[model samples]
Target: MIVAVWTISAGTVMPAAADADPPFDYLKVMRAEQMWKVADGSGITVAVVDSGFKEVPGVRSESVLPGVSVMSPPINDPDKKYPAHDDVEGHGTSMTAVIVGDGTGGAPKGLAPGAKVMPVRTSLGTTMAFAAGTEGAQGIRYAADNRAKIINLSWGDYYARDKIRDAVKYAQDKGALIFTTMGNDGDANNSGNLITMIPGVLGVGALDETGEPMELSSHGPDTDLSGYGGKARIRCRENSAWCVRNGGTSYATALTSAAAALVWSAHPDWTATQVARVLIQTAGGPVDGAKRNDWVGYGVARPSKVLVDRAGEPGAPDGDPLASPAPVKAPAPSQTAAAAAAPAKAAEAGLPWQWPALGAVVAVGLGLGFMVTVKRRRG
Candidate 1:
């Protein structure tokens, strides 16, 4: 069973390009700057389960926790000398910057500057290859065990495994809110895929500056909310002056994770479910008064409204905001046929089947069409 991790890269960069000014200011649009005055996501730990993370200008070591690697060659090989927190593909660095960057050295400020990042490396090398199912499941469990308040999965695939589903349930049981991308395929009916369709995980879609869904952002009923995922600025690597303008559902997931962190930090007593509910209820509705849509889910995530204005009602502490209707139970088979019928019935009940795909793992990054270049490091 092969699973490909999806990521969008803008290309390589040189040192001098970092000096250029940013093309857009996402903080102003999302009202993150105003929200920061009330809460900066302090005391919240967001587990970035991606390629890895690097110590950059805005992302300092004090804000990062010791993390583990679940990449292939070995699921949890302690003997591997490579640093688990290092970003070989620069994808994790970008996501990390979006979550906790401190805006030092002229870098763009992150949504939750006071938050701490827990890096969980699940991919290796520049190509971001890994033992997809095993490593991903291990990574999720590790983040939950480490007491992460939020888990950010910036990568996803069409195939879903029982191990991964069980791991997601484990995290939810542990009170960790999980967020994942809705993919970049731009398909109209993107609901049948794995990862995003998994119960208890919030699927995020990308939104452009105009508050409409990005043309490339996947649309599906599973998309819980939208965020600024188009051409958003993010740090490339440690000690780099240039930030890349990349767009994908991965960025949406990261930004939403930061928003969750902010809400959780401000209301430390709130359960993961309560925080999720606030985000959904307080999201900016469309001009037409339509509460929900597949293209942008509940609408653009407006954390500032929740934090600054104290808007939204966190209904039930333990209620799942994205819970699907209960599945109908099939009648039990006769004693003799029960054993043979159980597996088939479960399969027919929407159990995920493994499918092979090229590229065992992938991470999102900036693509071409921009003048700035991004320099990447591989270990």
Candidate 2:
């Protein structure tokens, strides 16, 4: 696959060094504060597959597991380690803080403060590369084998490789939920190519404070969900007290991953499919469209709706929500009749008031299955 270089945008606004409380405007908008009171993602390990992760004072060291380097030529020199991982550019650290930072020393608190982070270092530079071409794939398999329930891939590329797809399938079969970013191509029509369009993995998009899709957020038929990606407040490098404003689908992906952790932690018995269903059913509000859109997929991720409101029912434990029947080579009358009869049943069932005008949506095989897709924008 032609993996794109994942770099933090220089356009990030660096706040003046101060001890004031970090503004968590995005958290407030998403009502994450309310959800945190119920479940802070305890016992959930989110594997952050990025450049590398930094262990900051605000983030408990125990919460961050020992990370591994998958870079070509094995860039694991101790001198090159930043907070014990080879993150020379600090992108992975920024993502780590958003997932598990404790908000000490005036830094922004992570959405899932109780969740643990597993750093799977894949590369050294801004762009990730593997000499053996299987390093990225191997890192994913490693994360799943180590008992990581959630895997966050905040980077993407244009090329799609069979090994990457197989790895994603392996992780999904192992009951691990994976999230990736849609490229930041800035196409208004939402016509951007993604590196991997696997059946089960989610492609996250970016949303601004106004509840509108970010201008730079990629969109397409594969976009499963959207999250807050505009100017998120994050802590600086490992031992630094400084804070900066970063924006991109990468941060959005991390935030979504944290939201998943919150829900999964609360309902440890639920399967990955169930957790994904709850998120989709409870996402967005009446102000947003009742039906899913191509830009924001199932609307913005609203974890509070699932954790606090306890809305939505997870249909099946093992069903593939994204699976649709392959286009028939020739439509038989019975198949056409079944398709025609679905809307009538759905209408009679009556969707909840929270999701107006969405009763027409149907699931192919499962009784109430709903497929979720995601995309991300580059920072």
Candidate 3:
């Protein structure tokens, strides 16, 4: 399988120009090498649900399982039963690489290289945007039925869909842990995302090196955990050795899912809720020591605290950590117009499959005291 290698780069240290090298790499900041001794996600399966996926040459993994697709009208070839391993837009491929990449070309390794990926192609945007909500629901249910322990939804939409919530419940009932982005609209628009706001899902947010929330990270009551969302390295183009792009909760969600995979792999008998509880309990990024905050929710996830240090207690194997209904927040009027303009692709506040230049994200030195982000992913 041709896999694309992606290193998440977000925050102050990342240069604005696409051509400029990022000061940090994902592996180094996360200390993936050290944690590998405890768990490498062996026997874990992470289901990636996005518009579609394509493989990049050189990036390889042991298993990129062929899973079902819920996309209608077929993309590319009508005869093809599944979305081909062809990522026309980089989103799906990048999400997969960050989770299960074999680290063939360089040091920027995936957070959980030993895990398996079950790719479930759904409409995040483009030709299939019209049915994205229904198809996404189908994808979630399908992954749960197919033995995926962790489901990663890197894409999101502003509007809530009843079908989507039903799907989330179905997966949770089947013992699957779902992770979705907290969205990228940041504080300007706290509108909740369809997938993220669903009860029992981990709505991941982005955090910089200093444990501060990223300017673009969406926040609210439902935000579950934070991850290193910064400039990440990736083979954006087949020609370039590496390209760096600033990330939001989409990258954070993917890494958090990988973290769950690592934890589950180490203790195969642990239930999904137990894994979630331990992660929330062990997370320790914020300085205030708040049990849970709106900004970073349970603080930035500290898988190393669980894996290497063997920290945290997995309480109540059968009890659900998030059983109550999530408080639904109404979106600004503008958000509706923005989403209707471009289905699937716009994703409203979701991660753009194709990242705009750093200059587009913001001018350098926004005066927020953005800390320098530095780390690299590789062996």
Candidate 4:
């Protein structure tokens, strides 16, 4: 008898076993109350577009309103019930955890636990190779039309596609604050790294706990702001009952989006533009006189400060704070490397990986199921 073997390798993919209870106490952050004071994100909807999320023990459930699978299965057919969206790669699940995971035991808790998560499962890895066309864009449009206030995109590609930009614009018009990760690989200094700079998209970079940049975080003229995307890594569900040490801009983008949710939930009346403005104006920038760095953009997001002053009261709904920031100065290439030291070995322990204790309930076959097909119709 032969058993099929599937490996969720390190760095390349995240496994479900890594999802522990909310490990980091977001309350410890100085701005925790200020950010949470204004909004709990109770009624707003956030769309997570990435690998399907796994139906983990406590993470995902009826609370996560399951949206339709937009990525047509590899074999282009009109009629097939796409497997319920589950995270095959764990990346999507991790992002979801960061966005809305109920802070259980030391598990990773999202900034806004009260917000509703609209799961928009798209293809990753092999699925991308097959369904890279209009299907993904259509999925984005579908999520926007369905009423998602914030769209958190922890994934991105180098090749600029007009379809994606159009879809993003549509979502923005519908009042979605779109956030995307600046691709990992800035150390290589790829000349064509403007993937995050496309108009209307807020490109995010990675910063350590001490508020410094990470080297692997891509730097370009388009970067918007940095977040806690440091060496401290999250867990993957595969391999052992633990997670590996890794960091990237993907984490930063999700963190910032969740932070935005906290604010939006507090002031449900604020427009996407107002949310973006408050974040930029309140963010922590360079220590020196320099204003904004291409790598860190407006600098690390400082939600606590923003929420503190504007708590219980909404700021200008149409104000655009980021528009008036002094022109950003290009830091010497050497500055990025120096900033990398911020997420040193010491900061590594901050991100903890907790494996869920699956009761007999999880023993159900659905616990670790993967759906590779797409059904055209849903009951």
Number of the predicted model whose TM-score against the real structure is largest? 1
Model 1 Cα shift for residue 69 (angstroms): 1.3
Model 3 TM-score is 0.76
Better of 1 and 2 by lDDT: 1
Displacement of residue 163 (Cα, Å) in model 1 is 1.7
lDDT of 1 by residue, 210-249 (tens): 4445656766667677787766565554424445565578
In terms of lDDT, which candidate is strongest? 1
Model 1 residue 125 CA deviation in Å:
5.5
Clash counts per candidate, in order, are: 16, 11, 22, 26
Worst 10 residues of 4 by lDDT: 358-367
| Candidate 4 TM-score, C-alpha based | 0.74
List model 2 lDDT by residue over 173-233, tens digit each: 7899888877565543343534336677787777654444565776666766677776555
Using lDDT as the yardstick, the better of models 3 and 4 is 3
The deviation in Å at residue 74 for candidate 3 is 6.6
Q: In candidate 4, which residue ranges exceed 4 Å CA deviation? A: 1-27, 58-62, 76-78, 130-133, 191-195, 231-244, 311-316, 319-321, 326-379
Report lDDT (Cα) of residue 145, candidate 1: 98
Error of 3 at 339 (Å): 38
Report how far residue 51 has shifted in candidate 1, in Å. 0.7
What's each prediction's TM-score?
Answer: 0.77, 0.75, 0.76, 0.74
